[model samples]
Target: MIDSFLTSYKIILASNSPRRKQFLTDLKIPFEVKTANIDEVYPDHLVKGEITDYLAKLKAAPLEKDLKDNQILITSDTIVWHNDTALGKPVNEAEAFSMLSNLSGTNHQVISSVCLTTKKQQLVESVTTEVTFKDLTPEEINYYIANYQPFDKAGAYGIQEWIGYIGITSIAGSYNNVVGLPTAKFYELLKKLV
Candidate 1:
């Protein structure tokens, strides 16, 4: 099992996302959640995977220096990239509605980046998943926003939620990446550390 690959080290997950936490649990990679607040802001010039990669590493900045040699720190970031723009968490229902509306009947890329840090080394990787949504009606969008409250999710939607059940027409890559982490690719990267 994958846990055997991590037996030498304690794992630290640097994120508050319940979904990400559940992912590690599902993978049976024992880890404890720890988080520090940092401005989610990125430079204007960075695009797509570059943006998420930068943020994932940035999320590790405060935690990496404190890691023990036997502790591995994991940090991640996810963004919905549509029409050359990065869609992040919405601040309100109106913004959430707008984001989902833009995504209606169109394909967008969900980019997630994961960073692994040990006292002596660091590895970062980004994965992108293309998702297509059905043409969403206003009522459907309103219902999802009102009930799911996806203000915390990029693109104002969760691929595991009701919106996904009804709206997502197709997905071209790792579903876990769209959900926030890319477990298969991440498992491959972890092998490098072992």
Candidate 2:
């Protein structure tokens, strides 16, 4: 496995997301977790992938400075883009419902950017997935918010949750990106590091 191949270096993942951690686990890449509170603000002019790439690297900047040559740090960010607007994590139930309502029967892009940093080299990349939802009813959106409490998710919903099972009509790219991380693209990037 990659454990032997990467024996010379230690991998550190700078995220607390269970989904992101699970991705590294499922990929069989050995890594340690480290996190810092970063203000995820980006310039207003940055759109979709740019926003994510900037944020991902922004999340990495603080943690990357002290990294040892034998350590590689991975950081990432995701956002839901619809109608030329970015829908981040909802602040409350009403906001969650409102975000979902706008996404109903519409196509939105799920953009995720992953940044890998070492003391000597750095790389950042992104993947965007298009998702379409069936016309959602007020009742359905209300039920999802009340039961699932999607306040932590962007676009006010988790694609791997009940909403995805019942509401998502189709997806045109990596579902993993929508869930949290872009596993395949991330793996390809990791290969580049080696």
Candidate 3:
């Protein structure tokens, strides 16, 4: 269904996330993964969606000059906003544990933004999902960390993994956003352009 919308254009997914790649593949959208190594740093003043939006747009920048008239490039970024701070990918076990501990028994916003660029148009949109986790004990967090090794994931957890199976009590918005990308919202955006 989605492929029909992009029949005339080549879709390029510019992200390293396996989940994001899988989501687009499951949608049966014909796209090729093309990633660029860019500094993920952003200004301190940017908050939540602003931060992700900026990064998503930034990820698209390097690909701008290479876009052909029939090629559309998609870039995205995800951040876990808890207690007014953004929790990015943990650098080590200690940091991951610290992040998980802070998220225990609390509600945090998972913000994901997607930027789409074509030769003639650019569009960016974001979705936020509020996720609530049950209070996780040290034993459980440790076990998950040891078993799953969520070092590459933001928020020190993956919603589709063991932690999500046992820890997440509820979510207020798109589940896919928590996983990584907001597929429904993204589909709507693509539909509009086609």
Tens-digit per-residue lDDT, 1-194, candidate 1: 55676788899999989999999999888999888999999999999999999999999999888999899899999999999999999999999999999999999999999999999999999999999999999999999999999988999999999999999999999999999999987888788898
Candidate 3 stretches greater than 4 Å from native: none
TM-score of 2: 0.97
Runs off by more than 4 Å, candidate 1: none
Q: In model 1, which range of ten residues has the least summed lDDT?
A: 1-10
TM-score, per-candidate, Cα-based:
0.98, 0.97, 0.97
Clashing pairs in 2: none
* Candidate 3 residue-wise lDDT, 1-194, digit = tens: 55666788899999878999999989888899898889999999999999999999999999888999989899989999999999999999999999999999999999999888898888899999999999999999999999999988889999999999999999999999999999998888887778
- Looking at model 1, residue 32 earns an lDDT score of 91
Q: What is the lDDT of candidate 3?
A: 0.93
C-alpha lDDT of all candidate models, in order? 0.94, 0.92, 0.93
Better model by TM-score, 1 or 3? 1
Clashes of each: 0, 0, 0
Best by lDDT: 1
Q: Point out the worst 10-residue segment of candidate 2 by lDDT.
A: 1-10
